[model samples]
Target chain A: MSLQDILTTGTAPKRVAAGMGFWKSLFSALDTPVAAPSSVPADDPLAGYGPQAVEITPAIAANQRLILSTRRDIDLQELEALCDAVGWSRRPVRKVRRALDNSFLVVSLWEQLAQQRRLIGFARATSDHAFNATIWDVVINPSFQGQGLGRVLMEYVIAQLQQAEIPNITLFADPHVVDFYRRLGFVLDPEGIKGMFWYPS
Target chain B: MSLQDILTTGTAPKRVAAGMGFWKSLFSALDTPVAAPSSVPADDPLAGYGPQAVEITPAIAANQRLILSTRRDIDLQELEALCDAVGWSRRPVRKVRRALDNSFLVVSLWEQLAQQRRLIGFARATSDHAFNATIWDVVINPSFQGQGLGRVLMEYVIAQLQQAEIPNITLFADPHVVDFYRRLGFVLDPEGIKGMFWYPS
Candidate 1:
């Protein structure tokens, strides 16, 4: 087909926010904690997608009750403040905006007040949706840290990746907190695949 | 705010196909090769958003002239056939559909005929649009390989990621192809930060 004919014919690849008809329902399902159907005889919401899914704990159940979303239409200044609150390295506001907007998955946590919700935790990941993914910039507001909100946020990220069947998840952790991620299933690099990277000279 | 209140008050994070607005123009621009803006002060098409971008390369110039897109409304059967052609690991049609639907970026190539566009090359990446992204499933119909089509396709992916200001891009390459990616400016990972991963047994 000629360029003109090809462009005019067949469905042009529309960017699916994946909110299209069926995927829309699935995306909505990700928004809420759904009960397993009695007819199915299984209570695990993620059973069909993959074998590995987190067993919901009391802490998770309570934390899940809080507002969690993959929403990108968030306040940047509010995000900037949340970054500051968590003692994160400084990132320019614009850089952070592009990052969040383009993130493959962003798990957002909020504290719902009488009339407004304040940002409380955030974790974002870059993934291929099939095989490999790397997570970065995980944070939970200091006041909310020990309350299992971080676990809820990370578990949500893990479940999302797991559901997509992406098995290779890699992250670089500081020496002090290696055990935190170890408990969540991350391990040291297997001997053969040395992690090599280059930065601006 | 209550869950109901937050859901109702703040935007429920409508899936920004992101292709709907400015990105649509860029997506369309990617479909058609644009002359570098010389007389115009802003030579960079992606300038307002980020600092780095690729000069639409010669290979890209040729490929763009062919017809390129991120359209997700694709035929799964056709994809299955393409996967068969490339000898990729078998993925069920449903899984292929879901993966394509969720990829952060997808670049498709077509050979324009009088009436139809035949899929000739394909590349995709999963990115957070900021810090990290991984490219995957880079395959070209064997008949279309070795024409620098792969380079053209990858350069497009790199440019898109660079524009998002995502600094860290990693991909697992076979030893033989390491130089190919290195020529395109990827380097060995830095020693201290090893790449580590885990999978469910």
Candidate 2:
């Protein structure tokens, strides 16, 4: 069920079968041990996301909603499609796979259509548990962007970092979106405390 | 024999027996797949590290020579001693062990003293073989700090990252050492492109 459906119906998500051990280590390494919330508030902003709702055959409507997950069960095809959709400088699939598996926290969004969960929005973070955390690859399918899902996805990331008690959340944004992040309460690094980075050939 | 001794003798240091499989994955995950350097330039900067030399009894001189290694065989005692010597925030030994084992690249330095090698310097890095890499914990024992060991250690790291063809090398520097990095060719993030980060609590 979609996170919204569960929030609305006061039910829990169907837990996916995976070793909780990996999650435990990931959270521990990131400095915040977490248990997914038992239930979110009824009026949660997240619960309001049937935004682009369309009346379809009842059978299809039941399955075609945005599902949000905090797991690493990404499918290769779906991941590549998302990468292509965002034009992420083509990389070998294995390279992307290793990067995904190594991330400290990953929030994946899927939209069910034709009984298949097609990846839609994806964001991953790397953290040192106690000190530094960075947000990377915050992308939503262009078709889904303005429906408020981008904000929905980013808000989920910020909230998770906050809950983890991670004090530092850093991301480099394309110049066009500086204000978008400013609205989320991030400011430029302190004056003279600029960023420096080198890139590979 | 120490790295310096190998340099002096113009012979390859004996490769340690360990899981090549793990190093294979670590390097693949960090960036490019690499083979050990085929040769060293006769005028290599690493060779000049022995420039500060003193004549003493063979017994006394043996205790002061610099040693370097790119292996993961460091024991808990040496790691702990190095951490204590640097006055780092104390952490459980297991936590430090986990971090060390997870590093993408680690360059460690020791001083051959009597029959034991005392940890004197270390730097580790994390990277996505494609885009960004960060240098962290570039530390040297205070006793060895002023004699250019830190420079030797960091130069080794830079050369490795350069060989990996990693595009972006980033590090957060202490205010006092900004010029040290500045001399190494890093510049402030371009204007309007400042860095933003949150600290872990």
Point to the candidate with the largest DockQ.
Answer: 2
Residue-wise lDDT of candidate 2 within B80-110, one digit each (tens)? 7787897886767665666566656677876
In candidate 1, position B160 carries an lDDT of 60
Q: lDDT score, residue B201, model 2?
A: 19
Model 1 residue A56 CA deviation (Å) reads: 11
Give the C-alpha miss distance for residue B62 in model 2, angstroms: 7.6
Go through the candidates in order and give each one's C-alpha lDDT.
0.55, 0.55
| B179: Cα error in model 2, Å | 2.2
Residue B198 CA error for candidate 2 (Å)? 2.6
Model 1, A1-201: lDDT tens digits are 221232234232211111111111011223233445444446333333222222222222333324556666678888878989977778778778887776667777766433445788888877655666778788888876666566556656765676556777777565654666776666665544434342333
State the lDDT at A112 in candidate 1.
49
